[model samples]
Target: MQLFGGRKQDEALAKREEQVRKLETECRTLQTSLEDTRELVRHLDQDRELLLGALEHLRPGMDVQPQAQVLLDVCFKPLGLACFYVALADWDQDLLRFVLYHEGGRFRNHPSRRLSDRSGLSERVLAGRRPVYIRTLEEGRAAGSLLTAAEQATGLIPHSWYGVPLGRGSRPSGLVSFQSFQTDAFSEGRRRVMDALTGLLSICMDGPPTPQGR
Candidate 1:
């Protein structure tokens, strides 16, 4: 009877040891997976930084066209932007002339084109004084009346858009709008970074000297 009891105790100890070994193996596997996830996140964050947060690289006195090009190159192209437009308000407020426009695979300088009216999207965006990052263009049109028929028909219609006012506060001096042919092209993370970059863009409209470059 004494020998049988000793054997039972030994077997129990061996069973516990085996269980511990299995648990250790699972813990190691989980740790490896966690490390890999962290590394992937780190790379994504770096890409995000370069995509929108690097607007300061445009530098003061950078030509406005060059600045705009750099913005497209870094911000829109990497994220699959199809087109963009930049316009400044005339003192009369009767018109928002296109200062820089790119669409359907080309960029043009349309300093004379009258773009928006008092009730149009550009004016409304400035009046609303907030960035509108629409995940889908259909949703934007359905949500409210913004773009005019001419605005909608005159160019490459967008699938989605993210636009920001180019002035301080609700009374913006102008605006820069980016659009894409792909839905959900812009994300909240990009909007946050672009929001911070507005001041820099405003400065460039005059500081970078677009007029002299022409």
Candidate 2:
């Protein structure tokens, strides 16, 4: 009778320990989630302040390349963007030209891609005429090619990619893209900021005619 009683006691102790462990795990998860929420809130605040100053700097007469650089600068630190590019669509030629490409903390040349190329990421954005947010490069590759042959040879493969089309209607005039080495780099808040910036960029690009011409 003593032995049986002791066995029951052990079983109860084991169950209690298991419960403790589960509670500990739950606490850790909650802590992590809270920390993430705090960080996101902080970023949202910083982004808002930066954007206000950026708007003052981005004028219609400014060159496209300079404007691209300025936009990247505004979000580079806040969003962790490692790569950025602006590709203008050539509907007549069915091509997308990389007019402004920035990567590795510097500017670099990028090759153009055919709009009809189903394997390229730009084509997906153009076809949809909307923002394309890729959480990881693997996901992008599964749907279509993420990089060109030349890019594959020398470029850094980004873990996250986001592209927003410029203009509206059935066809967009261009694409502005940002990439990062970390997976899931863009949160919902970050995406909203990017979308806003891209929208502002579109207005500057297609806004009223200037003396210098577009």
Candidate 3:
């Protein structure tokens, strides 16, 4: 009877050990999931800040058009660009139409009604819905005639250009462009920042949906 009791005691201890190990594993998994949730919340918060900044143009008595233009212009400063353009995809014309443009700290509304689907840094982005950073105009492939009438009228073409598609999924509805007379003006960091800014811009203007969590 003493020997039977010892065997039963050992079995119970072994079962308790197995249960403890399983609990530890579950705890570790829960800890990882909690960390991931925290990180996602942080990113969403940052994105909200950006969206609010862009929407500040809608305040009462504010000049909405010029403010929108300048907001995009200043955002390009971090990219070290001298000029920026905002274009929307025109389904009727099957092209990207020039809407707002900023240069030399001046905003031009409806600079041109011309559709841009031929070639240039802009068309490439409109076609692919992806950001394209050009180090210099010399290395451009089939983009020699990409300048808009308004841009040409200014008598200055940026030597380098960076353009981002402004919409979600495979096809975007608009384009945001940054350009500079200096060659290789865009860096990897600048491109990444523009990606975030463009997303926020879309959220503000187009009401792009983000993950729900305040």
Candidate 4:
């Protein structure tokens, strides 16, 4: 009986130890899950702050040009790309006349130049009623004779490019184009930024034009 009692006590102790180990594992798993939840909350808070800032910038009565400049400056400067706002006169004309160009660094502004009337890409984009992404300058040059001439005249060598059409319904008002000297510089992230900027520009375009005197 004494031997049996000792054996029973040892068994109880072993079972107690097994229970403690299982409890410890469960506690560690809970701790890890809590940490993951905290990290997710922190990321959500950062995203909320970012979205709020963008909303504030998009408030009504803002100057369109300055707004566009701010968008390009903040969005593309880090990526090292040039941004341009082209205001078109007529959708049927198949032209994108330059309204403004925001250089990445200290580069001087190249004066506004007329688009080549024969540019099919420009016309197709305007008439197609959708945003057009020109991935390469070579594609543009090959599609239209005028593109090559324009490149030579301005010395604007674009290895990669993306453009968005700006207009409501049938009246295509303009286009916004981003360019980079490096090939395939516009990644998926950069493309999303451009989309947001273009959305803001589209809203601004619908409003009344600012007075020349102002």
Highest TM-score against the true fold, candidate: 2
lDDT of 1 by residue, 27-83 (tens): 999999999999768757855676445564666677666776666666665556677
| Model 2 lDDT tens row, 9-88 | 99999999999999999999999999999987888788887679679877876767788878877877767778888888
Name the runs in model 2 displaced over 4 angstroms.
1-38, 148-155, 209-214
Best by lDDT: 2
Worst 10 residues of 3 by lDDT: 58-67
What lDDT does each candidate get?
A: 0.69, 0.82, 0.67, 0.62
**Model 3, total clashes:** 0
TM-score of 2: 0.75
Model 3 lDDT per residue over 102-187, tens place: 77667665433334434456767767768877777676544543665566788676788878887767667778887888988765
Clashing pairs in 4: none
Each prediction's TM-score versus the true structure = 0.64, 0.75, 0.59, 0.56
Candidate 1 Cα outliers beyond 4 Å, as residue runs? 1-56, 109-116, 143-156, 206-214
lDDT of 4 by residue, 43-132 (tens): 556445434455566544565566666555555545567545444544355345555565434333444333445345555555566766
Better candidate number, 1 or 2, judged by lDDT: 2
Name the regions of candidate 3 deviating beyond 4 angstroms. 1-67, 76-78, 109-117, 141-145, 149-155, 208-214
